[model samples]
Target: MEERRRYRRLPIKLELEINSLFKQNNDIIKLNNKTIEVIDISKNGIGIMCSDNFPVNYYFNAKIEFDEERYFYCVVKIIRSSKQGNKYCLGCEFVGLADFLADKVDEYEELLNKSQIY
Candidate 1:
């Protein structure tokens, strides 16, 4: 596939909860506060590996905490999904992220580049 992404993806492992997941018709799927690993993140979206498969175009709410008091919340739209061994890898795009959150993501990407964190 051609490289078409406008934003560069930063490889970072973070634990987050999929607070809510909804189907195309808005039916909620119960996940029981499952903790999922965020494999990578970018200004546009994030990649997560989970035990379940996510339908493309479906939406979900995710909460990633940097610390006990600070966290980032966003509604994500699943763009692509694939199976990796026993787990499913999902690629999602932010529905509409606030400027502050977007800035934070950009800053994180910069830091990753500076420190060569991958």
Candidate 2:
């Protein structure tokens, strides 16, 4: 299959906490606190693996903590989902992310590549 993604995913792991979920019409869905694993990320989106059952096209708000001082909060829409053993792997697109942040993702990837050369 041909790769259709506009940006390449960086194989980085981060823990994200699902703060809320919403439908396309902006109706919120209440749920207990759940932590999920972010498997990969790009400028436009991220791939996550979690046990929480999220239907495709639904939007969820999550906070990704890069470190002690850096935290990013965003809304992501589920584009694809598949069962992986006991968990579900979801492909999602970030909604309304700022351009500078997207550029930061690209810069992070460049820095990672440079580190591996040493």
Candidate 3:
């Protein structure tokens, strides 16, 4: 497959609760008691694994904790998904995420690079 992503993905696992999830039909869903694990992050999007399936183009809001003290409350749109074993692995893109927060992600990536971590 051709690499068309504008930014590189950084491996960063963060668990966050879904405040709300909106389906394409404008229905609201609450995925409680299930941990939505953000497995990877980039300036434009994130890769997440969860027990529940997120339909493509559906949106969800959550507060993603980048670190112990840093958090980003943002809306994400599920762009793609696949069933990985018993888990639903989905790729999501930030919707209207601020540039500063994206910069923060870049900074984290640079730090990981310096540390020789992928």
TM-score winner between 2 and 3, please give it.
3
In model 2, which range of ten residues has the least summed lDDT? Answer: 62-71
Q: Candidate 3: global Cα-lDDT?
A: 0.85
* Candidate 2 residue pairs that clash: none
- Indicate whether candidate 1 or candidate 2 has the larger TM-score: 2
lDDT of 2 by residue, 8-109 (tens): 988877887776778979787776777889988888999999997688888988665555654577788999999999999999999998887677676667
Instruction: Give the TM-score comparing model 3 with the true structure, all chains together.
Output: 0.87
Cα lDDT of model 1 by residue, 1-118, tens digit: 9999988888877977776678778688777787778988888989899998867888888775544544688888999999999999999999889878877787776667788877
The CA lDDT of each predicted structure is 0.81, 0.81, 0.85
Q: What is the lDDT of candidate 1?
A: 0.81
Selected candidate, larger lDDT, 1 vs 3: 3
lDDT tens readout by residue for model 3, 4-116: 99998889978877766797687987666457898999889999998878778889877777676666778899999999999999999999999987788877877788999
